[model samples]
Target: MRYLRSRVVTFCISYALWLTLSFSVDWQHLLIGLLVSLFAAFLMGDMFAEQAHKWFSPRRYLWFMIYVFVFTWECFKANLDVARRVLNPHLPINPGIVKVKTILKTESGLTFLANFITLTPGTLSVDVNREEGVLYIHWIDVKTQDVEEASRIIVSKFERILKEVLE
Candidate 1:
């Protein structure tokens, strides 16, 4: 029963990803997608076996959608900010790594958050201390040296949403 559940979970996850990335749905395309997704499901059975139940809901997907919009808006805003700074005569940049703690417990969640941070305008995720729940981010405009404040500014935006989606 558990094995079946895991297989189903993996199939769902892989197929969802495939659909998101695929533009066409012809028979040839569908066959290849099915084969690849099944292969991935067989290999990563344990990933979705346990936590998949927590995320298998419409509400979770709704939260994920919200996160995507919020992240996209932030990305656009950050790009403009960076461009404005670059175009201006005064180069205002405080390029330094600040330690901020993350509450995401899963590796995938942390990795996604790290990628999000890196993709954002002025921030770059330098390193992650998984054991410490800490991430070192190089910020262009770091307003505080306090770790909690930094986390609130940089990581909190996605942590709760990511937890709902991935954890």
Candidate 2:
């Protein structure tokens, strides 16, 4: 009963957002759109239930939004730095892979952190050790090979945000 209610609420909110973003609704069109959304929601019932719980939690959702904003700002700064390096005659490119240890316990949190690292311009997640909870990342311009430094950069910025969201 709880799952059903959550799913319905999730579907309605999603449908409303879609309708607002995609089309100018008349009475007939609104009816049709609602029907289609309900069908889709029913098809993805379990997903809606899970996602609805995650998505509706105000604290978690707020942190996630903040994470995205901070990440975007950092990416922008990193892009400019990279561009400057590329344009200069003396290209200070220190490319290398660094193995960073992960402290996040949950799989979802770890996955989010890995994806976040990859999405950022300067770093890419090369491998993940699920058993040990470690991440190997290829950095475009590595300033230091020190594992602690590298891990600090990743964990303090992104991993923390992911932990807040997922855990």
Candidate 3:
């Protein structure tokens, strides 16, 4: 029962990704996408297999959508900020590695957070200390050295939304 549910979830996620990326409405393209996505999902179901009850909840889905919106906005803002710094004549930057803590208990959540930091402009996740729940991020503009403040600025509501969605 659990196996079937995991495969279904994997298939849905894989197919959704395929549809978003394929950008085609033709039946031939869809048929190919369906086959490829199903094959990939069958081969990699274990990677994302989870307790179906937890993720299927409406609340979790809501939070996930909210997280997506928040992440997109932050990404856009970060890009603009980076552009401004780069175009400046003085090239003002305080390039430094700063540590930030996350309360996300699950490995998937922590990994997502790390990747989120790396994907956003002006910041790169250099390392993660899982035991200590600390992430060392290289920032183009390191505003503070304090751990709490850095976490507040870097992680912010992302952690809260992720925790709500994943846990």
Best by TM-score: 1
Least well predicted 10-residue stretch by lDDT in candidate 3: 46-55
Ranking by lDDT: 1, 3, 2
> What is the C-alpha local distance difference test score of candidate 3?
0.85
Clashing pairs in 1: none
Give per-residue CA lDDT, model 3, range 1-167, as digits (tens). 34667777888888889888988889998999899888877877766756555757899899889989988988898889888998999999989999999898778788889888876768899999889999999998889999999999888768888888887
Whole-model lDDT values for every prediction: 0.86, 0.79, 0.85
lDDT tens string, model 1, 14-131?
A: 8888877886878787888899999988878776555666556888789889989988998998889889999989888877889999999788888989999987878999999899
- Once fitted onto the true fold, the runs of candidate 3 whose alpha carbons sit more than 4 angstroms away are 18-38, 119-121
lDDT of 2 by residue, 1-167 (tens): 54686568767876997788768767887787788888877777665445455666789988989998988887787788778889999987888999888878766777788878887768889999988888899998887788888898865677777878887
Candidate 2 collision pairs: none
Which of candidates 1 and 3 reaches a greater lDDT?
1
In terms of TM-score, which candidate is stronger, 1 or 3? Answer: 1
Best by lDDT: 1
| Cα shift from native, residue 156, model 2 (Å) | 2.4
